[model samples]
Target: MSHFIKQNDPSDLFFPGGLFLNSDTFPTSFFSLFPSSSSSSKASTVSCFSWGPTSRTKVVSVFSVIGGGGGGDFLSLSLSFNSRSNEDHQKHGRESRENVEQHEKKKVCEEEEKENNNVGLVSHGSGAINMTKHLWAGAVAAMVSRTFVAPLERLKLEYIVRGEQRNLFELIQAIATSQGLKGFWKGNFVNILRTAPFKAINFYAYDTYRNKLTRMMGNEESTNFERFVAGAAAGITATLLCLPMDTIRTVMVAPGGEALGGIVGALRHVIKTEGFFSLYKGLVPSIISMAPSGAVFYGVYDILKTAYLHSPEGMKRIEHMKEEDQGLNALEQLELGPFRTLLYGAIAGCCSEAATYPFEVIRRQLQMQVSTTRMNAMATCVKIVEQGGVPALYAGLTPSLLQVLPSAAISYLVYEFMKIVLKVESS
Candidate 1:
């Protein structure tokens, strides 16, 4: 076995200016402050220092500053250096660096959390403003479109109810002769009251359902099926909620009826004469007609829009328009530079209205008889078929299509344009 001798240097025990001459002369009272290990196999060194005994009060004050000022004890400090392998030293240094980095990361995360909280508040305020704008757009679109087609709508209602085959001019002259020029908009106020909120709810609900379903399916783009389903749900919900208003409007517009004073008077008369359920007399047929009609309309519209956007000419036109109108939204861009959007909207309206025309006749018949005969949807359909055969079920298809096509086209155009304008203004 080989023996190694340990050597200690005098300079290691002294301060820079020779404050301590040797290790033996250093204060021994504060030695207990330092931990001493007797295991010499592990090479280690301990250095202890304190203010002199003569300045014990000053030492206590210095200790207070260095030791968090908790006690009056004299100042004492110990520094220990342990000899270890290079790997151990490197490991310790890495751990110290990691701890510092973790602390800094925690501080940054706290700041980001605070900033996100503020952003959430701002987003909530903006969300409410956006919803209000959407409601306004929907209400305005419904009122304008309905107003434009009021005369045709009244004529169609008369044909469906009375089986009148008069031409447009004759129908107008008859209404003028009976109720004067104001008869052109016989039940327009009731229509507006019914349609405004109905359209607004439909629009808002469709967007809500579409967004939720898209997120659930993890899809950025919704398929035509999704759009159709969302539209059907929106239509059904709106129709069910607003069925009473629709029934009242139909009754007020039917030709050869005693004039109801106004919406309030019509509602009171219906409820007083024929119970509350009369207000929703044809709800089943109305839902049956509207659900599929809304589905077809929205599905066709979405399919047509997608097809147009995918066409080379449509893409080129959009790019050209983008250069001219940088503020256009995605929907507005689809409408740019062509009447294709109008044509597509008209086609969708025609298809949906044609498919559901028979149901419209059935619904109108049921509503018209609210004060007279209380017939279920099945009885009404059977009676109509017996009286005039299957063609009677489609009595007013021509005027219905004529009125609906332009109404749908104009409503969609105005709605999409308003959304873009509002978005741009807000931005």
Candidate 2:
């Protein structure tokens, strides 16, 4: 195969929605390095791989601003591979082995480009656009579903504090009898506030880190391990950022006079009685589960997105469409924007919560104790296991599933719609 680099002005490419072209777009330099292929070869291969989140971010932004954007590149690239010959396959394999060295060179080039672009005042107004969209969506969704979260949390707490195995109906009745209908929303506002920002920051951080790391590693693609680190880091950061809010939310949600009174009262009670550190109860388990959950959720979403956008049928349709209708038209785009993000968020939330549901039980128990001396999170886990039996770790799993499935779905859907509406008005 013969290789060549194709460079072009950004204006030469189709402007999907006619948005701002930053400094990089003017007199832009992009490498479309292609491998050379010998004619008469039964099978030929051309693999164009780019590391870093630039393309991903671009697509997301396109979708956010214009209603629809280009789908994941890898998905399309994979489809191209189906027609490759044996010789092409071998060549591709050889190149894959040297992917690391090629990546290092690419990184240097990207860094230089970034520095130069910055000097020219190329503002990334579009930077973090997707992140913002996700954040707003998440916050709105969380707010809409606050009641569900509160009730599930309440049931989970009751199972831990009162040793009750009550059904949802029973739990609802019990909570109503004790705290009234308003009790269902206890600590809800706090949860919405905390979860929205937490989800936004954590999700964006993971994407940012993963892209940067993949680019540095010289890998043409993000490896699972890299994704894991990114997800884990984001999860930890989010947990820490929202820890105080979580503590307050949890205290308020749990049924106890000391915690129920107000934020000030809760703060004083935890400080004067349980000590300042009590605010971080159940932190460990939360951190542990968050990372993998994020990795799986985002990674899977990326993969699926890639596949969908690149499928032969999908590509054919896109290529065949008129310029105006080629990408996503306004109405088509609007219809999909909110629902897609909503589905993505819901899937991530449910999968993550399910994987960590047991830990959720343990954390609530630890927090509800109103007292504990263990400095480490692991010790708390051990203590809970020894005292409550292994089964106790999942006491409220039912309620969690009940609440999370619909709540997440509703929250994400509403969030996406709200974001689109806001974008429409802003535009």
Best by lDDT: 1
Regions more than 4 Å wrong, model 1 = 1-112, 255-259, 327-338, 371-373, 424-427
Residue 368 displacement (Å), model 2:
3.0
Give all candidates' CA lDDT scores.
Answer: 0.72, 0.60
List the RMSD of every prediction in angstroms.
10.6, 30.2
Q: Could you tell me which residue pairs clash in candidate 2? A: 1-36, 1-37, 2-35, 2-36, 2-37, 3-36, 103-218, 141-411
Residue pairs in candidate 1 whose N, alpha carbon or C atoms collide under 3 angstroms: none
Q: How accurate is candidate 1 locally (lDDT)?
A: 0.72
How many backbone clashes does every candidate have?
0, 8
lDDT of 1 by residue, 42-62 (tens): 212343344433222212121
Q: Candidate 2, which segments miss by more than 4 Å at Cα?
A: 1-138, 145-150, 160-162, 177-180, 218-224, 258-260, 312-331, 334-345, 370-379, 411-427
Q: For model 2, how big is the CA root-mean-square deviation? A: 30.2
TM-score, cand. 1 vs. native: 0.72
Candidate 2: 10-residue stretch with minimal lDDT: 59-68
